[model samples]
Target: MSTTPRARVGRPRATAGSTQLAPRDEILDAAAALFVENGFAATTTRAIAERIGIRQASLYYHFAGKDDILVELLERTVRPSVEFAKTLREDPSLASAAALHTLAVRDVETLAAAPHNIGTLYLLPEANRDRFDGFRASRRELRDAYGAFAMDAATDALRATWTLAELGAAIIHLVEIVIPLRRDGEMIDAVRIADACLRLCGLDDAAIAAATGR
Candidate 1:
C-alpha cells in the first residue's frame, strides 16, 4: 500500500513559464516571432526550444519538427476563412455581395488576429516545399472561394471586364494587405477593407453599405 504509482513514460510536458499559452501554443508563438524577425531558415529547433525555455525534445512532443510547426502555422493562415467561406456558400439568404463582404471581413480579421502576424512567413521559400502541400491546397481553396464569391458579387459590367480568376485574386490580395499593415504597425479595420473589396468588384456606396452593414 505504501508503494508509489509508476511515473508516466513518454515525452514530458513543458514546465510552466512566462507565457500563458498552453505548451504547444507557446512554442508556436515563440517560433512565429523568431521566424519573422530572424528569417525562417535561420531559426532552428533548438532556438525555438530556447525561446520557450524548454528542452528541444519537449518540442517534439508537440510537433514532429520545425517543418511540422511551419505547416501548421501556414494552414492556420487560411483554414478559418476557407471554412467560413464554405458556410457562407450554403446560406441562400445572403446575397452574393453581402456574402463576399462577410467573407472578406472574416479573412481580414483572421490575418489581423494571427499570433505575431505569422502570415508574414507566408512568402518563405521553404513554405513552397512538398512538405507544405497540404497548406498550399488549403490556401488554394480559400483563393477559389474568394474568386467564386467575387464572380457572384460582380456587376454585369465588372464581370464582362474581369474574369473570375482576376476578381478572386484581387479580393484575396486586398485582404492580405493586413499582413503588411500589421508589420508596419498600421491600423486594421476589417469593415473598411471588406468595403474596399466590394468596391473593387464594382459595387457602389449604397450597395457596399448594404453588403457591409455600415
Candidate 2:
C-alpha cells in the first residue's frame, strides 16, 4: 500500500446545528448595532452583513429580512419587562407604589444591560407595520401595565388633570430618554431616576425613599 495519510485529530468540527446557530447570533448582534445607529428603516442587510464580514445572502439564511431582525431584537429587549409587569399584576399583595418603584428599577437595569440603545427602535416608523404586530402588542401590554401602576399613584385631581394612560406614557418616555443618556456615560443613577418618576406621580421624597428603598 502506498503511504496512507494518517488520520489527523484536532478540535472536533462544530455540529451542523450549532454551526448554523453561530451565524444567526452574529447576524443578530450586527443588526442590533446597525439598527440602533441608523434606525431600522435606514439599515440594510448588506450593511449588517458587511459589519459582520458575512454575505448579505448569508444574513438572510438566518433571518427572513431586516424586519425579522428587528422583531427578534424587540423580543429580546421588551419581553422581560412584559413578563415582569405580568408578575407584578398578579401579585395583589404588593403595594402599588412599591411595585412601581421596583418596575422602574428593573426596567432601567434591562435597558442598561442591552448592547445598543433599544429605545431608539421605538421611534421607528416601521414599528407600526403589520409585520411587527407582536412587538406592538407586547409594547402595548407594557404600557397598560404602567398605566395600572400610575393609576395607583394618581390622586383624584391628578387623575382628572392627566389620564392614567398619559401618566404611564410619560414614565416610559422618561426611562427611554434616561437609558440612552446613561449608555452615553452620563452620571445617571437608577434609584434617583426611579425616585424622580415617583415624584411625577406625586410621591414625596420620604414616600419615594420608602417605596424605592432608597
Candidate 3:
C-alpha cells in the first residue's frame, strides 16, 4: 500500500484576496496602521495578522515579531530625510539659507506622504529602547543637518547669540508640529512651512523669499 503523504506544516502562503500586497509589504502596511492608530506598545502581532486576514504565525514569515515590524516602519518614516540631509551636508555649493529651506520642504513632504503619521511613533516609550537605536541615530543626523544651517547663518558673533542646538531644535519643531497642525486638509504647503522654518533660523524676509523663490 502507498504511504499517505505527510501533511504540510507551518503557516500557509497568503491568499490573493486576503492581501494583494506581497506578504512582507502587506504586513508592514498593516503594522504601520496599527502602530499609528494604537500606540506601538498596544499593537500586537496577532492584531496585525488579523488586519491582513492572515494567521498570526504567518506574520513570522515576514517579521520576527512586533518589534521588527515597528523598527522597519520607523526606518521608512525617517530614512528619506536622513539620506537627503547627508546630501545637503556634502554639497558645499549650497548656501546656508537655501540648504535650510530645501531640507525643511523635503522633510515636511516626506512626513505628509507617509500612509500614517509615523512621526507620532517617536513619542512611544518603546522607541527609546536600545532596539530602536537606528531610528535615534537617523534623527540625530537630521538634527545635525539643521544645526549646520543654523551655524552658517550666524555670520557674526552678535548674530550667533542663539545656540546652534537651539536653532536646530526650532526647525525640528516646525517640521514635527507646526506643519502638520497647519496642513490644509491632506495637503501641506511645504514651501510655506520651509519659509517659516528659515525665518525661525533668523533669515530675514528677503533671504527667505530668495531661498524659497517665492
How much does candidate 3 score in TM-score? 0.87
Candidate 1 or 3, higher lDDT? 1
Looking at candidate 2, what is the lDDT of residue 132?
Answer: 88
Tell me the tens digit of each residue's lDDT in model 1 across 1-214: 5999999999776654757888888899898888888989999999999887888889988998899998888888899999999999999998889899889989999999898899998888998899999998898788888888888888889989988777888888899999999999998999899889889988899989877677
Error at 175, model 3, angstroms: 0.9
Q: Global CA lDDT of candidate 1, please?
A: 0.89
Minimal lDDT window, size 10, model 3:
178-187
Task: Please list the Cα RMSD from the true structure of every candidate, rounded to 1 decimal place.
Answer: 2.5, 5.6, 2.6
The lDDT values for all models are 0.89, 0.76, 0.78
Higher lDDT: candidate 1 or 2? 1
Tens-place lDDT digits, model 3, residues 32-89 = 8898778787899989988988888778887899988888888876789878888887
Question: Candidate 1 regions off by >4 Å?
Answer: 1-8
Lowest-scoring 10 consecutive residues by lDDT in candidate 2?
11-20
